[model samples]
Target: MRVTVIGAGAVGGALAALLDRAGHEVSVTARGDHAVALTESGLTLDGGFGAHRAGVAVVARVPADTRLVIVATKANDTAAALAGVDVPSGCPVMVLQNGLGGDELVRSVLPGSPVGVGLALFAASLVGPGRVTVTAAAPLVIGGDARSVAVALPVLRAALPERVDVSADIRGAQWTKLVINQVNALPAITGLSVQQTVADDRLRRVLGAAMAETVAVGAALGVSWQAIGPVDAAALRPLQAPGAEGVAAGEELARMLARGMGDVPNPASMLQSIRRGRVTEVDQINGAVAAAGRAAGVATPVSDAIIALVHEVERTAAFVTPADAATRVSTTQD
Candidate 1:
């Protein structure tokens, strides 16, 4: 398979290295110093998968005759990332991004091509130029047209260490992932790792409130949320209720977060973005939830507050600390 992975950041870097190691002809598109490093020394992947390097073609432009195109850019940068690539008509393009609407964007860009959407259920971070650290491992869900799945599944399974499941209802899978990603903004706003943020009772309450709102909005939009990996969206509905059930739901959510964290203290992607002085993806994550809530006539006070605080932090170059953001979020709930 001739694979071109756009956005040679954490997710794309790891995928490129793994696919190259799996004997596929892999090419990665990156920018700046990372592009230079990849072209010069190849890509290095470290962590539980062990250190491995593979020689892959790194380019600023998407090469011709590419069989599989994996769009791994950040949600906000998806448009710019695909703008340069001239995708072959009928080629399968897989969108591996957080939140929603990425698949549609790819479909719009490459009309007549089979577009598959995937939820990357693992944690990976770019440690340095041309290097990525895979801190956690989980199944990657790819869902779309059957033809697209047939084109993507075998090669993706061989390249990734985790299992690959083809979903009949990819939108449901996406909604499930969106629900799980609601906590990502909390870590960015509070300057804490996901584990720390979920472990705090107060913070967990806020997260629970936001996630409940997301579920309500999804319901209003007629999306039947399904389970993504180990996260059962249906089970989380209790968090929306008042009294003891909601408390139990919060505790259950915390326990699930702890289990997901496992032994890896990996920071959420938004937290990493803030640390790098890059704009966070709060708009696509929490902002998406709030937008849906408004359309559904559901109040999303918690999500709205998180969005405002994250934007403020980004605008002021993180003048607000995590503790201060948490205080603001709490006050909003009141």
Candidate 2:
């Protein structure tokens, strides 16, 4: 299969390497120094799966004979990344991004193409130009039109790891990922790895509050939540209701997150963005939840405070302590 990855960031680069290793013809579109580096040195992937260097075709323009197009650009860059690229009619385009609305955005771009939505649960980060580190590996869920899934499955299976699955309810899966992503801003604001952030009891309560608010908003919007990996969205409903039982359920949810994470010091994408001096995706992740909550008349004070703190840190280029985040979370009124 001939694949074209639209972004050479973490997920894009990692998938490109995996595909190339799987013996597919892979080309990646990148910009600035990253493009130059990929062209000169190829792609280097390191960490848990060992090291691999693949000489993938690095191009600024989308290649013509590409069998599949993978949109791996950041949520905010999705529009600009695909603006000029011409995708063939009826070709399958898979959007591998965080947060929501990525599939619809891709559909808007290539109306003739089948847009498949993917929720990538793994952790990969761009540690250097033309290099990415895979900290964790998890299943990639592809869902949408049946024809599109048929087109994307073989190519993705060939290029990606063995944990890829197709779903009929992709939107529900996406909402599930979004609810999980609400915890991402906490790590970014506090400058801690995801595991460490979730391990702290105070921070875990904050995460619970944010997640509970997200689940509420999602419910109000008529969105059904599906379980992503081991985190059961149905089990989390108890956290949304007010009571001592709900508090206990929230604590259990936090513990579940901690256990799922183990001791891996993997940083969330938003934290990685701050470390790279790039604008974090708090707006699309936690901020999206808060926005939906407002429209649905559900309060999202926890998520709102986290968004504010993350943006402030982004502006000042300073690290926020976990203690500071706890203080803000405590004072935030639901």
Candidate 3:
């Protein structure tokens, strides 16, 4: 398969490397310093998995021969990154992003091609120019079937260590992922890893409340989203101790929280946005919840507060300490 990946940051870099190693012709679209680095030196993969270098074509613009186009750019860069890409009339584009709007945005931009939503369970970071670190092993959930499963699945399965589940309901899966993402903000404030934040008894309370709020909105919007990964509250409780009786019941939460933080040196995506002076995905994540809350007549004061705080950090371009964030999140329920 010939694959054109638009964003060569963490998600795009990892996907390009994996696909290239799987014997597909992978061309990455990058610009300026990142493109120069990839041209001079191949991409670097580091973390729990042993690092391997694979040869891939680097280009400043998308060519005419792209078969499957994967848009893995940040939520904010979706429009501009897509503006340059030239896709065939029938080529399928999968949006692997962090929030709720990828499918619609792509459809609005490129109406002819089939657009699908992808839920990335794995954790990856662009450690440096032309380098990506795989922090945790999580499945990449895909929706839509315009492309052949026999052709694309084999390539995806061979490249990624995590299993790929082709979902009939991609929106539901995204909502489920969003339910888990509510805690992403918490880790930034608490200064803890994903597992550590879930393991802490007090932090677990804060996260649980946040997720419950998201779930309320999800239910109202007719989207079914249950937290599936170890990121869920049920998975976090056992890591604390059996005595933590108030948390949800689940066996995998403990094991998930027990796993070592893979290779995430940078903060989670939302936290990174706050640090980078970019607008966080609050509008898509918690803000989406708040919007749904309004339609469904559900009160989402907690989500509203988190959205405001993160937006303030986005506008100010100052490092909002995790402790301060934790204090804000902790007080929301009261």
Candidate 1 global CA lDDT score: 0.81
Q: How much RMSD separates candidate 3 from the native structure?
A: 4.2
Each prediction's Cα lDDT score? 0.81, 0.81, 0.69
Task: Give me the displacement of residue 236 in model 2, in angstroms.
Answer: 2.0
The better candidate by TM-score, 1 or 2, is 1
Each prediction's TM-score versus the true structure: 0.94, 0.94, 0.84
> Which 10 consecutive residues of model 3 have the lowest summed lDDT?
242-251
* TM accuracy, model 2: 0.94
Give me the runs in candidate 3 sitting further than 4 Å from their true place: 148-151, 188-192, 199-202, 226-266, 321-323, 330-333
Residue 74 local lDDT, model 1:
88
Residue-by-residue lDDT tens digits, candidate 3, 195-234: 6666666556556666666666666677754344545334
Report the alpha-carbon TM-score of model 3 versus the true structure. Answer: 0.84
**Candidate 1 deviant stretches above 4 angstroms:** 319-322
For model 3, what is the C-alpha lDDT against the true structure? 0.69
Native-to-model Cα distance after best TM-score fit, residue 161 in candidate 2, in Å: 2.9
